[model samples]
Each structure stands twice: as structure tokens, then as C-alpha cells.
Target: MTAAKTETFTSLAASVLDIEARSVSDLKRYLDANFTRACECLLACKGRVIVLGMGKSGHIGGKIAATLASTGTPAFFVHPGEASHGDLGMITSDDVVLAISNSGETGEVLSIAPLIKRRGAHLISMTGNPQSTLAELADVHICIAVEQEACPLGLAPTSSTTATLAMGDALAVALLHARGFTADDFAMSHPGGSLGRRLLLHIHDVMHKGERMPLVNADASLSDALLEMSRKGLGMTGIVDAQQRLVGVFTDGDLRRILDQRIDVHQAQIDRVMTRNPITISADVLAAEGLKLMEDRKINGLFAVDDAQKPVGALNMHDLLKAGVM
Candidate 1:
């Protein structure tokens, strides 16, 4: 890149960062009675939060809606222009409308203000101009004013948009805390992602169960145990008693240790080299918990035992990796 081009980009980036920093810092003073009022209004809302905005504000509103939804506040974004064209039907008296417009004078958003109010829905507005018409009509107004735009032209919404998004995040988090939203609740809303898999997946869902679990009798020969482990492809075999109770575990790691001792694998009974009373898990435990156990104990695999202490399942580190719980 040319030096001139690099300078221009660097200056613009610095301006944007400085403006946003000031915008967020200025928000502390606004967290007064008005912010409390807005939170209380939202807390009293019986239904969903209906977010609406236009232009740059609308883009921020979409993200705000997603944050609110994932944080335990049921919310969805509606384009104000579309709301006037038929989407307003989605709003009900039980819902609360959160409208965003820096000028507080977006034509599309103003167009539905009366319709929303007529439906007896609560109206909340986030704007740079509290005196503007949209704020005047709103039941609650949040100020997101900035000292100046990052744009040298002082026209584009750089700092103002960032401030608005930050305010929306603040509101969502306040409501989340008020509702006591938990990580598990967030996981439920995001099950398709790795986080959800880690938080929600249980050992029973991914562990090899029933006869598929690699297992051998305590009296089994080393060759027999090896065949069981090979067939199950779990790299380990459980040694069980006559009543199918887990007695020990034989793994590839154990094989190496035994080899170092110059033991004859061909003639040895698997029980002699197996780890007795190995660490095990219950079928109902979360996969994430299983991973933690393995990491903390410095082990690579676990057996899932039933109420009577009989081996019912088996799982390993690879299982967690495959299930996206690692």
C-alpha cells in the first residue's frame, strides 16, 4: 500500500476508536433514574420485546434483538418500513416495542409509533435527540447521544451507531441479570453451536452402550481383550466379573507399561495388567463434566456405570471430540 493510503486508513481508524470510546464513557452519566425506569418497564412486560429501527440503527437493532433473545429476553427485530406494510400485525398488546433512531425522527419508525401505541403496547426509544418527535411519543426514552461523529464529514453514523448498540447491550444484560438467566438457558438457545454441544451433551448420548461397549471377562486372555478393544475401536477394554460388574480397565497405555516391564502379553491374563477400580462416570453426566474429570485426573477414557455398579457404557477423549464437546 502507498504511504498516503496507509495514513488515510490509520487516521480514520483512530478517529473511529476515539469517538466510540468517548460515546461509551459518556453513557455512565445517563445511567440515572431514566435508565432504571426503562429497565422497570421492560421487566413488567408480559410478552416479547419487539425491536424496530431504520438505516444504520436498524442494523444495530437486529443485533440487539439477537442478544436479547439469547440472554433470556424473548425479542425479534422488525423493519419499521415493513411493519407499516403488514408486519405490525406481529405486535400484540402484551409485547413491548423498542425503537431506535439517532435523530429520533426516522420516518419509517415514526409511521408505526401511533399504531403500536394504539395497540396498547409499551414504546421504548433509543435516540441521540431526546426532544425529537419519536422520543416525545415513546413511553420510555434512552439517550445514546455522542459528542461527534467519527466521520470527518460529521454526517455518517459512526460513533452514534456504536453508542446505540452498546446501550442495547446494556439493556439486554440488565434484563438478563434481573431474570437470573443462566448459562444453561443460553446453551438451550444455541444448541447448533459448539458451546451448546459442550454444555448440553451428556455422556449417555455419545458413549458406546450395551454390548457395543468394549468389554472382556476378568479371566479373559490378553488376546481376547485386545480383540474386544479392536472390535469396538475404543482403544480400551473393560474387565468385568461374573455378574458383569466392572473390575478393571485395560488400555493401550497399560499395554505400553506392561511391555516396558518385559511381561509376556501372549500368555498374561488381562486382569493382571488392567487398572483396578478405574475412574467412571454416570450415564446422566454432562459431556463437559466428563472432559473436566479426564483433564483433572489426567486420564483419557472412562466407563459409565449403572446404579448397581455394572459397566453399562464406555467413552474416550475421541468421543468427546467427535461430539464437539471438547
Candidate 2:
């Protein structure tokens, strides 16, 4: 492209962004009793929120439904075109229908409005024109009007779609707060994602337990501690007392320092070289917290202890990395 064409493209992109931003900002004025009623209707709904739209609005509706479903609201999108061809059976009397149309007179959406009403389902319309047929027939009408389209010809759905999406997000977030939705709750809906791993994975779920735990008695020889560390492959061993209470930890880093001193590994006692009163974590804490602790303490290994400070489990930076906690 020529320099003048490049400048024109950049200017057009900036104008689009500015127009879309203003459209969303303008929606704040429309958050009146209708928005509150929309939230209340959704909260009181016993069945899923059935979102219906066509074309560009349908795409936005699908995302809106997904956001609502993941944020403590039961929702799903039903394409208006599909709805007329047997998908209408998916809706029930207890459900709430969220119908979106930038023009407020989409034929496919309007064609099924009466059937939805006949089923006793509540209808909430989101439209750019409040006086349109859909708004008049809806139990609650949310106006998503934008002054102009970001398209230079004023024929595309750019600014209008942005406003509709923003309104949907506003409703989802408001309902999320009203329902006191938490990270743990959100994790339940997205258990396969990284956020779910961070919120739902506990230390006990990933730490090496039982015989996998690297441990040695406090009176054991340095060679014995080394053997346990090598066998467990965690690069560390816990030093415990006769009652099995963890008294200290000996790691590969400690070995490097001890080797520099020319210590006799065969005869040296573990207690003499061990780090006493080392930092520890409970098995019940989130693995993400363990990652933070490892970063903060500048250590790669940690012991998961019982209430009595007994080493019940062991983990290293490699273990966390393998478990997707790193």
C-alpha cells in the first residue's frame, strides 16, 4: 500500500475503536429499571436462559450465553433459524428468553416470539430501537442503541454489536456479583483450564506421598540421607525424629556446600548438615500457593507436613512443573 493508503487505514481503525468505545460508554445511561428487572428475572428463573439471535447478533449471543453459564447462571444459545425448525422444543415454560437483534425486527426472531410467549416463557429483548416490535412484546427491553456504525458506509454491525456484547457482559457480571460467584465456583465450570488447575488443585493432589516421600532419621548418616534423596529422585530428604516429626531437611544445594568443606559423607550425621526448622506447607493448601512459596523462599523443593510437623509428602519444582502449577 502507498503512504497515503497506509495513513487512511490507520485513521479508519482509530475511528472504529473510538466509535465502539463511545457506544459501550453510552450504554451506562440505559442501565435503568429495565436492567434491574432483567437481572431479577434471570435470578428468579428456575430453568436456563435461552438466548436467541440471528447472523452477527447470534454470534454475540452465543458468547453471551457462555459467559453467563460460566459465571453462575445457567444459559445456552439457540439460533433463531434453528429454533423455527424444531429447536424451539428446547425451551420450556420456566425458561427466560434473551432475544437480540440490532434492528429489533429480525424476521426469524420475531417469527418465534409468539410461540415463546405461548409456552409461558419470559422474553427479554435487546435491541437498538426501543420502539420496535420486539421491544413492545418483551417483558423487559434492554436498549443497546449506538449513535452510528463503525463502518464508514453506516451499514455494518460494528458499533451495534460491540454495544450488545458489552450489555451482555454487564448483565453477566452483575449477576455474578449478586450471586456471590467465587473463583472456586468458576473453576468448577472450567475444570480443564489453567485457572481451574490454580484454583482447584491442592498440594495433596500432586505431592509424592507414602514410600515416595524422601525421608531419613535425624541420626542417619549423610550417606543414608543421600541414598534416600537419590532413591526418591526429589533431590532432597526430610530428617525426622524417633516420633516421625520432621526436624530438618537436607537438599542437593546443601550437599554442594558440604562437599566444598570436604565433609566425610560416610560418617557425618544428617543432623549436623541438615537445615533445621525449614519452611513447610500443609497438604490441604492449593498447589499455586506452594509455587508462590517456592518462588518467595528461593527453593525448589518443599515438604508437605502433618499437624505435628511430620513429613507426609515431598515435592520439587519439577513436580510442580509436571503438575501444571509452575
Most lDDT-accurate candidate: 2
Task: Give all TM-scores, in the order shown.
Answer: 0.95, 0.97
Scored against the true structure, residue 19 in model 1 reaches a CA lDDT of 80
Off by over 4 Å in 1: 2-8
lDDT by residue for model 2 (205-307), tens? 9999999999999899999999998999999999999999999999999999999999999999999999999999999999999999999999999999999
What TM-score would candidate 2 get against the native? 0.97
> Which parts of model 2 are misplaced by more than 4 Å?
1-3
Report lDDT (CA) for all predictions.
0.92, 0.96
Report residue 126 deviation for candidate 1 (angstroms). Answer: 0.6
Error of 2 at 151 (Å): 1.1
TM-score of 1: 0.95
What's the CA RMSD of model 1 in angstroms? 1.5
